[model samples]
Target: MSSVQPYVPNKDFIYRAADALADSHLQQALAKAGRGFVDKRSAAVTRVPNFEAMRDRARAVRQKALQDLDIYLLHFEKKVTEAGGQVHWAETPAQMREIVLQLCARHSATRVTKGKSMVGEEVYLNEALEKAGITPFETDLGEYILQLAKEPPSHIVAPALHKTRAQIQDLFLHHHALGERDLSAVEAIVDEARQVIRDRFLRADIGITGANLLIAETGTVAIATNEGNGDLTATLPRAHIVTTTIDRVVPTWEDASAILRVLARSATGQQTTTYTSFFTGARGDTDKDGPEAFHVVLLDNRRSQLLGSEYQEMLHCIRCGACMNHCPVYQAVGGHTYDSVYPGPMGAVLTPLLRHRDGDYQLPNASTFCGRCESVCPVKIPLPDLMRKLRNREQQEARFKGAGYWITKVFCALAASPRLYRALTSIGTKLAAALGARRGRFSKLPLLGGWTAHRDFPAPQGGSFQSQWRRNGKAQPPVGACPAGD
Candidate 1:
């Protein structure tokens, strides 16, 4: 038997998070981009009367599809073969990369045009192509920006959401041969990128894209985009290759529609993206113009294992990125802080499970269990519950230990005993109140440098809730009433 190597997380998450916090450019970019998504989504949902019902239907479709994943995949394969296209299953990233390379090599592909695909990012497909001496051109505007800057995407839907206009101007000036053209306006930047990529689109032999949903009923791949880059990438090249995960499949076009109804609304606050293209197979004999060859590379990458597990619901994710857009942690530190291809709340749970590596354990702990991710998810994935499951598994596997664990243990033990808990709380509260009576808050405190270093800790004013309740002789509301606790 071959030995499997353990996964090791990127060690730069903490340092990068701190740097992002201090970076004025990144902060400004994030601030400008954050509220736009939130507001647009809010307006979109308000415009739809049955938005919640649509979400429920989307969730149900995903659940049903995952329940019979193998059956649907086989059906999809049969349909694809019947339609004169090919289906390739890859159990790992390495296998997927190799498969794509072989296909490109067979076609003598030199230059490849690419649409935005997170799965490609997962397998580092661009690097693989470059290593094999093939050049890959990013067609998506945001992707092109990141490609020129040599940075991984900060957000899934909006890859360059972390970059400001000033930064983009500098990148374009440094990379493009613009003869003193004024690049200050956003329109100029768009035009510059469009002109550059249009040539690549026409010249490329192969085009690679990710599917929003794979329809098993018709062997069709559906993609949604605002810029129509995916359409150009699919139709312009001699061969079109789809690199996507198994979880993206749906049983039928109806299922795809159910999900699509909420996808754009959740993703960018639009009722639908400007371009929603569907391609089934290679160009038909009567077709005016399309790819000569069609290939689908479906990657498992541990998602198959995820189907039957407690984390199965995560497969329902439509990649709309509503969770991340609303996530406080993602908004504060940005996507690069997570040190994974997927970032924010979804990444926190999904990355560790998919990677199952050493440092991934830290990801689950990254959340405050705020549950905003679950609240905003278009497919209703219980992100907080899944993260908690990972944390519990870590505890059971003894993946974490030390003063923190012991402190939690001691607190739990004390919490179970009312007398001891009261005694400790009373003493601590009195001490803190007395020390900060004049200042009203503590700027520094021993054994709490983590909290005090960034912000002041407000001094305890009143006694414990139980103590206050006893003195007032008032009945307290149930815990559920106070969902947002201090």
Candidate 2:
């Protein structure tokens, strides 16, 4: 395997993954996963008559919560304290890491067992712990695989989905100290993970997890998982910590229930997760297995700036992975191409927002604006619209607002003129088709060398749709009128 690091915003990694993803193997895997997820989601939607209405209601709840975030966050903190838990606020990733490390120090933690929390990933918690000499063990299977591989998450929901069973088997055989045995099946592989990690749960000094939703009214945190890993990570140690973005807060337990109704179904086609546990505080009266101390770290990390902005709707994401599941681009390239902890449609929107790009540019233009993501989002987030806003952000940045930007603006202005647009389109299509006709595809592109390096370019069609429409007496019809026959 290549020693390539997680595809951060580094220009080189982005281009490399874009090139590597062109291989047929990656394409086949992405296509299979994408189509399967969409079909399953469609079937699930059909099963619920009020699915659309439920999404609308979920949207309303999240909107109301975000609109009044300050009020609800304070309410959440008060109740959590009342329930025998302490709340900590982090304004940035550095502060978040510092607080967690101090908490670990307070417990004299030598080893920390962790559940899969993307917020923790966002803060690079494992690295922080390692720097402080605390060994952080990933309890979630997917996370465990990634930790063994020393790789960041490729996809948000399915962290190890990109790795096939064979790869996993190979990883286990090479990494696990157990003597040789059959590793042909998924069950065997899971057994290996469990055998290795089960002891870590009991031996660790602290347990940490990510919260799905934080209920302000009850001061309760919800953890949803298919595996029992989250439970182990939350209960097996003396101290338990939940790291989450401030956006996770819901006004009340009733509102959280409403969101949960859509979260699992949209995520994995389950009406409810196999394990949806609500923890109010640490181990209490008659609670023998839970931790003695509970702490919730609410990370701001640029989110407060996003509150009143056009991209605020993105805060509603429940990490369901629906948008990525249905995205055509993500299907073709997998999550690696996006070059971040977040990937796919939601990543396309959130990565640029968090990373702070400088230019008349953001990377989400990589899409065709199909709007399928928006249609399927359980919380009704307008993903494409937000993606466009990110693009505008690039334009607003001074670094990218120069000559290249003016040229692009001029081209868009020209393209708006129908006569010139059709002429340019006709000429470009003719040239492209002619260039590719000999071999059925263009092996290289003039301006998009990175795009063409690994895959052949699809030739343009002979005629534009608008041209065909105009030739058939469909030109200049009334704004809302039907075709000539109608």
Candidate 3:
């Protein structure tokens, strides 16, 4: 049982969420990144004709890929082998780490530079590299900042979205001795980071990046980055390794193209990334510069088990960060509150599936069910639906804590018998209607005071729905669903 971010141990999700809500610095950081991501994606999508159609195409591509995942993956592996690259399959993070470490050791790698990869985060590759005594450098500006600060990423696309400009300035000033260089302007800060990591790309023996999309038709892996670091990281090193999950494999370059069209627009609101580089395999005799050895390590990590299951739709995510930007809960509490490699709506459904620790189920409860995450998702993953499913499953499994345990047990018991349920609700509603008609709403309740403290709970105007339905005689249920039995 390895943690998602080993450097930072897990904490109680509810407590962390409360802390996140209270922290002013975190509030400032969330306010800065949340609005910008939403606005940029909104503006970018508007500029494209049939953006919704593009999303539909991308969603179809993913669904088709996963539907025939085995065919595409085998085809991808064969293509890689033909192109003078090796493909290694890992069923777990440990196996993936071992595969990568063996690759690094074989290459005699002492220095490694990494592109920003959530797959890398999922496997905790940085921690593995450090434990193996290899010096790993993060080339993405946001990743580099978090690396220097020894913190896990808050957002997937923008890792340091939780850090303010002032905070980054302090990190650089403490870590580097840049003399009299004004690092106040945003451009200056970017320049400073560029200067700092310029040589790591050249000196590194191994470069590892995550695949944004993998093409089975051409045996090519594509990476998209705002910074050109991914290009340098992949090309400059003696060996290149792609650390990605098996779900990234698409059937063809056309399918890959379909996804790429939406990836950048949803991520940074750019039509395309500044550098969307594709690599097939090792450099040939005629090629001047590229990695001598190329490897694509596909980590399963329980993802293959999800195929044909209800949760398989999660595999469609493109890591655009659009869901997080639009998510009210994520905007308020930030990614760190989820305490997983992933955060926000995606993580709420994913973290528990990947790592079901004590508090993992709590993530599904973090949502407001506003459906914003689903609305903004480029792949159209039913995130709210998935989260609701997880929440229901958790309660059914009785995986709750303390007072919540008994409370949920009581509620579930009450809900099991239709007769008891209708009878209890009939009496309760009548009681509330009669008592609270004067005030119209309850300011406090025994168990729901926290909710009532902020807003009044409306008193029921009459008997329960079942009672009213029977009284009406010709009444119908909403949406034409069959009426419940009593």
Candidate 4:
């Protein structure tokens, strides 16, 4: 899908999604997808006894590589140049766009076909190409659907998850020249897309793709996918342009193998992706069919600023989409609510850093802080901690930080004082008990209507354990104070 850069406030997105979620169909879809993803990933991970150990190794590999990123990047540049390819460093999206535009101009190309690459989405390449009088085509089925509908992707892996099959049939009937043919089944849809994208692949002048991993030691781009669209995009056109973030570098192919083992299991419950293609350079003179010109654009849009920081772990993400698959917020709201190229738990952290750092402040507050994302992450990225850090950064420094800041600060400070905490707890419990509904749930709350907009909040219990202990004349609880399971 192309880039969508309009700002979205967090409150508005939450409310909108909360409303959409009330629909039984959407809720059913979310529940079905969530259980399927969780179960499949669990089964896939169970098959591998040493997956946790591999995660540890993968984490260390990325950490060490990030320490000397510049060295590895220069090494990559040299190797790529030696192999009859070019490497361009783009410090910003605009610079990347300019470079690709210039490449198109040099080639005198009007049509460009793309593999589904998030980096290409990051730079809004299709829109930029269109503005430059070039027609850009998305070859991935989900991406093509979003392209035809003129909508941002709703999920990272399944961009068209929000669209029903009937909606797709209508879309195809309206767009495809097949002119109202029977398109009711999934296989039929697949066949239709394959037929349409074949022509675009053959006639396109330049192809663009994203790399899953960039091997710094060999200057190879590793494109992983269930479909071989990436390979088609990289090799079929006259010129192939790879758009990748600077942080994708790991040190070696060995490291790539380790990460790959975890990526597919986490992403789609497959043992390995159907196609894992590694390209060292342009198709050589001895090679038969590959792009004549190859360009690898290393994009550093705010990634350089992320080095030696708390958020550096985000760089280790392989874009596996595991976090999104397991995320509660993403399962409900999908990608569009975040209103960024990157979406879900990872997007909550990365989007604000990548685009609209000041005014576009809604990206960070889009989570429930459930640690499932971290648990399912193949590289063991501390997503929840990173999210809290982003929220803290916004509260402390971002110009668009919201009100109620002092109130939150006051509560935190009160919690630090035992006497004040006890006093507040007593008062809060009594008030909650007095004002709560018969079922002990509050339908609405002052200054917290957002929380009660869609569902009721359970009221606090009438007494704290500390207060009960005090009343019972016991400073210490019994040995079996722990719950039954404990």
Candidate 5:
């Protein structure tokens, strides 16, 4: 019942992306955040012997779980009930929010501490909590930073990834009462937030966390976090609730371990998270720790419909941010531009399927087709391929009369005949060459202002491939490397 309605702004990707590209502070933040993740992942996998093999195993585990997802989910539910915990099925975000509110009301919970939950973000759970008169404190540092800023998470793992250190300093100064504390260092900033949230953790009436893996064999919920707050939040409170989607479940402990191995390597480039904790139901009669009541609310939200579809592989995703980290478009503009609870390549594929009315068809065409997303995927979800499929779906459905539809239609017409394509491309190249003769690059152009407005687009130099091939008598370039433009 605690799932929040979508707080994510569903804006046109083109307009928002233009705004993001023009934002200097956001640009700095993206540059700073993007490289660290890429380098760390490279290093982490380099350290592991045959990391590819581990990824293969993880992919197999996920595929197997998805194949029999219903069976595993039922097994998981049975185990939870046997361990004295209840399972609630939420078909929609509203149902999820209602279920959580009822649990909070049952316990008369006024304050709740929460670990990072992407599912919560999907539902805008924090907003719902405030609406319900329950104060929820975010214990994770990244989530806490974003909460203070009153911003939705830009990136999944690093929710505040689009915030520079200076911006964070400003946020803290505005939010906290620090007379003369030296807050120059990143560590100091984190410590200050830790000190602030510590009391909330101890005093909260209930705790809610998202599960990284749900094991059917033991009906155990596992969470992996850099901060130890998840363990504290779950065990310290009188009531514990796990809010997550059904796709998170796996068949057994071993399968969970296999996913974890790649999950760490893919996410943050660590061999393991700083704290990986597991919980089964509530505290036992002889046990002195854990909440008296434990509940798991699993949201379907049409994910079950994707079970046998082309996108079933998407459910295999481990929520690792690797795909976005390696994405050039995301690196350039950052997450908020996508205007989705999920962003980047994964979001480009999933968001449209989940909420088709979000004007997200343009998302599929957001790729350069580098395929880094598929290459780096822990569970190997073919992100680019899925996006391509969505693109085809959009074309078939004739969803919109936007620029993409017309452009794609023109391209398709041209692609049907080599002669027409060659003739048109030759004329187009020569025309572009003549137009840019003064500068050798275009600062702006019709239908291409998205790229040209921010940066220069190098005009065609040598000639179209057809002309060059005909002139050179083969696939070799035309004699001159550069055209007369410059």
Candidate 6:
């Protein structure tokens, strides 16, 4: 239904990653934002005595919701209808775009204001609206900056985290028509954005936002934000449209509370986001002020198919961005390199499953399997395991081949035979140590040029573990008893 060109994924993620590594501006932005998030989250967690227990509770809530997803969804729809709101089910991105366009058409909306909605980006809703002769204004400061720059979000919670303050000032100066004024401070930038967005909000015919959690019991769409833009976006316009996925539904407000307990702490390290607003359908006769018409567009987009699949655990994601915040790979390459709306660890698993296209298969292979993503996840989604499963699925489907495949096969074969493994490892370690003993590190290696390309690889010290164990009077286990290890 969208007249715009179909979204083309950037297949050159490796190349993009290389470019990101070379980008000084991106590197600085990443370093600054990454440390801030890590420190804040660490401090926030320390304040809560039972943060781990809260994570367990959040995981249980999500798991229970997913187990009976259909029931909760039905109940959600029933409550929305009871509140005089309409619920539209969209099985795919195309269907979602069409549904939203129809809703806009019903209201004859020309100017739409939006709060930060990743689902909107997932479906390319802004482009669709543009094609339909509708103008959508992004109210969130980060999202607004990206909109002006015509770029995708670089971070989930902080969508424009990749941009520097100087870059933002330039963007605002170029896009905003309000005669150049002093824009040297952070307050200046926020004030300017506020002034510009306030006018747009007042003139908007429709407001669109994403839901953090949907409570089936009361058909309440809960949104958490620091800017209060979501509240304005949901309340100001004549019509309010909630664009979100089906996986966001929970059985009750109490379940929503459990997830919220972890969401803010994991995201911005605040005990709670500044503004937490709830919307239930349209404004009633007794209501003082609210949208006249309310609609919720629930997008499946392969999520229903993923319910019983190996990737079902991924649905537990609360979009806290903590996994990505702590991911070393994400820090190095930045979100844009992933070339998907969803980036970082969560994106590595999600983009491939949701998109399922060529080049996307490389995402799962982008990790070092350091397991920090899983450690920081609020819901404790096994990100590393899911990525491994994706990699396995790729290999099973023969999506990976050539040198990489043969190398893995050779390693597996060698690893299967303990005698061969120990012999090769001993010889390899001794050879590496001998070769790099002068420098204590290898600046270059025959088959591992890529590893040494960025930094020196530490030379192995002394004999292999098995050899040292034998030298220390430890009895050697049977050949197959010890798994392959260095």
Runs in model 5 lying further than 4 Å from the true structure: 1-10, 422-464, 467-486
C-alpha RMSD by candidate, in order: 5.2, 4.5, 4.9, 3.4, 4.7, 4.5
Clashing pairs in 6: none
Of 1 and 5, the candidate ranking higher by lDDT: 1
Least accurate 10 contiguous residues by lDDT in model 4: 1-10
Q: What is the lDDT of candidate 2?
A: 0.84
Question: Clash number for every model?
Answer: 0, 4, 0, 0, 9, 0
- Candidate 4 has what TM-score? 0.91
Q: Quote the positional error of residue 424 for candidate 5 in Å.
A: 4.5
Model 1 error, position 39 (Å): 0.2
lDDT of 3: 0.90
Candidate 3 residue-wise lDDT, 1-486, digit = tens = 222243454478878988888988889998877578788899999997899999999999999999899999999999989989999999999999999999999999989999989989998899999999999999999999999888999999988888899888878877888766778999999988888899898799999999998899978999988789999999999999999999998998889889999999998899999988899999988899899999999999989878889999999998998998899999998889999889999999999998877789989999999999999899999999999889878867863346776777788899998899998998899999988999999998788988997999999998787787888746653554656672
* Residue pairs with backbone atoms closer than 3 Å in model 3 (clashes): none
Q: Say which prediction, candidate 3 or candidate 6, comes out ahead on lDDT.
A: 6
Cα lDDT for residue 86, candidate 2: 96
Question: TM-score of every model?
Answer: 0.93, 0.86, 0.90, 0.91, 0.90, 0.93
* lDDT tens per residue, model 1, 187-261: 999999999888999999999999999999999999999998899999999999999999999999999999999
| lDDT tens readout by residue for model 6, 261-322 | 99999999999999988899999999999999999999999988889998899999999999
lDDT for 219 in candidate 3 is 86
Whole-model Cα lDDT of every candidate shown, in order:
0.90, 0.84, 0.90, 0.82, 0.89, 0.92
RMSD of 6: 4.5
- Candidate with better TM-score, 2 vs 4: 4
Clashing pairs in 2: 359-394, 360-394, 360-395, 361-394
Q: Can you list the residue pairs that collide in candidate 5?
A: 1-96, 1-97, 1-98, 1-99, 1-100, 2-96, 2-97, 4-123, 4-124
**lDDT score of residue 219 within candidate 5:** 94
